[model samples]
Target: MSDLFDLIIPPNPPREVMADGAMLLRGAALPYETDILTAIQTIATRSPFRHMVTPGGYVMSVAMTNCGAAGWVTDRTGYRYDALDPESGQPWPVMPASFLDLAVSAATEAGYPDFMPDACLINRYEPGARLSLHQDKNERDFANPIVSVSLGLPATFQFGGLKRNDPVRKFALRHGDVAVWGGPSRLRYHGVPKLKDGEHGTVGRMRLNLTFRGAL
Candidate 1:
């Protein structure tokens, strides 16, 4: 009788995966993908994407822009969050409602509720572009979680321990996936490996990543 009852019950829905303190909310952002893309299009029109130069004078391979109260910028001076766009000399576009709502929802689902992000860094990657492992320590506080949403082409995300030389775990992040990390994993080193050649129907041969954080 009990076995028959079990057979009739449906299986549980997908749940978030935990790696260290990081939470991988698979497919959590799918419902908002269209809206997010639309918001990106509007933001790009205001502040076009560009490859920012590092303080060391090397240009980043990934084209990046931001939408929120603060935008991340890198140059000879160093990497820091500024209220104004260095390129246009105007304030970065406001964070879209869809972007902010998705971020908050993902964070809450990952057990970090009330996660209000004041900055959303948008990264565009074409074939062969890659980001080296680095820690996000520029933020004013580590208490807030970092919420990253993946869209378009799939890519391998390299998540490492606190140390730069620590071994990394590569996770395949697909469109509409969201990864959240905070608390113990707040300062962990992470990055994306070189994107392989691929064609995404809506986005073409590229990938877009939205990383939301609380920055003063």
Candidate 2:
């Protein structure tokens, strides 16, 4: 696929296999792109995005916030999901209907039906920003799959095996692409390489990721 053509106007993306238990639904989130961005804006107004500090004392390059019953957070205290925003001292913003609908639709398309994610972690990445490989182990259950929606600039998504040293596969994820992993691939390690400089018409010079998980 031509990256240039995909950047401008993508053909309706079809469901493709990324791994044994992972599926990539290309352009699945296009219909909800507008609503999702609007919802992100609304969520940010309430909880806001901040570059969180990891337990190791390193500041993350990706700015993050959340909307749902709980929000994923990290600091010197270690990583965990909290019901309230540490900054606001109030419950994280409620997950919007549009967000819930899109997530469920994408998840269903990827063969995971009835994916009711209680937490939506929003990540913003600019040039030079990256996410090291990690697993979503904070969740209580691995039965539920992870449904992630990508928007704005393109990114290099890395997926590896359960062990950190396991061989990694790279996937080019563009706006509107949704990746869902569960079952055999639930404990896979994944991350994003540093984003290259690019300007997206709607999201500007950065990329936004909406990662939904059952973090109860």
Candidate 3:
């Protein structure tokens, strides 16, 4: 059978507002799915995905890797961006042009016209994987929007206010969807709930998220 992507992702994807500065562009990345997936595979072959450890000594549930001028990493020392992959002692793989184009286009659509991402953090989530509520504050500049592209199984996304106790709005992030948040919502707390079991035609039994940011 075909991937059935055409049935899931409409030609005119709607942009749903999540907050003052956040939005969900449904099926925004559908057209470039094949090319984006190819780039991810190539990047993984070089840097590979691994569960990172937090400074508190807890192992993260999500497996991650990256590409571009810098890569986000966490260890006993602390959470921060590193120009070189700790595992390889070399700079992370260069960001693919396909990826850059997708990020820039998505950001522009989200109202951030001058967004130029320096880091592409690729996260892989398996069944039962969960990401706790956290702010994306490691980036040096908050003016650039965070462009997150979803691939594979659908999962519940959490978007909340600046404080941890703020009420969170939950929504499903389906395959090929792109989420963007910046400006007033740049430092907002957000995360994904535990992933459920499922198989996607393009990405199989797991979810792949490409989060582009200005890490440098």
- Candidates in order have lDDT scores of 0.92, 0.93, 0.94
Q: Each model's number of backbone clashes?
A: 0, 0, 0
- Candidate 3, which segments miss by more than 4 Å at Cα? 1-11
Prediction 1 global C-alpha lDDT? 0.92
Ten contiguous residues with the weakest lDDT in model 1:
10-19
Q: Name every residue pair that clashes in candidate 1.
A: none
Best-matching candidate per TM-score: 3
Please identify model 2 stretches exceeding 4 Å from their true place.
1-12
In candidate 1, which residue ranges exceed 4 Å CA deviation? 1-13
How many residue pairs of model 3 clash at the backbone?
0
Tens-place lDDT per residue, model 2, 1-216, is 599888899566688898988999988898898898988888899888999999999999999999999999999999999999999999999999988998898888777897899999999999999999999999998999999999999999999999999999999999999999998999999999999999999999999999999999
Candidate 1 lands at a TM-score of 0.93
By summed lDDT, the worst window of 10 consecutive residues in model 3 runs over: 1-10
Task: Tell me how far the alpha carbon of residue 59 in candidate 2 is from the true structure, in angstroms, after superposition.
Answer: 0.5
Model 2 lDDT, full chain set: 0.93
What is the TM-score of candidate 3? 0.94
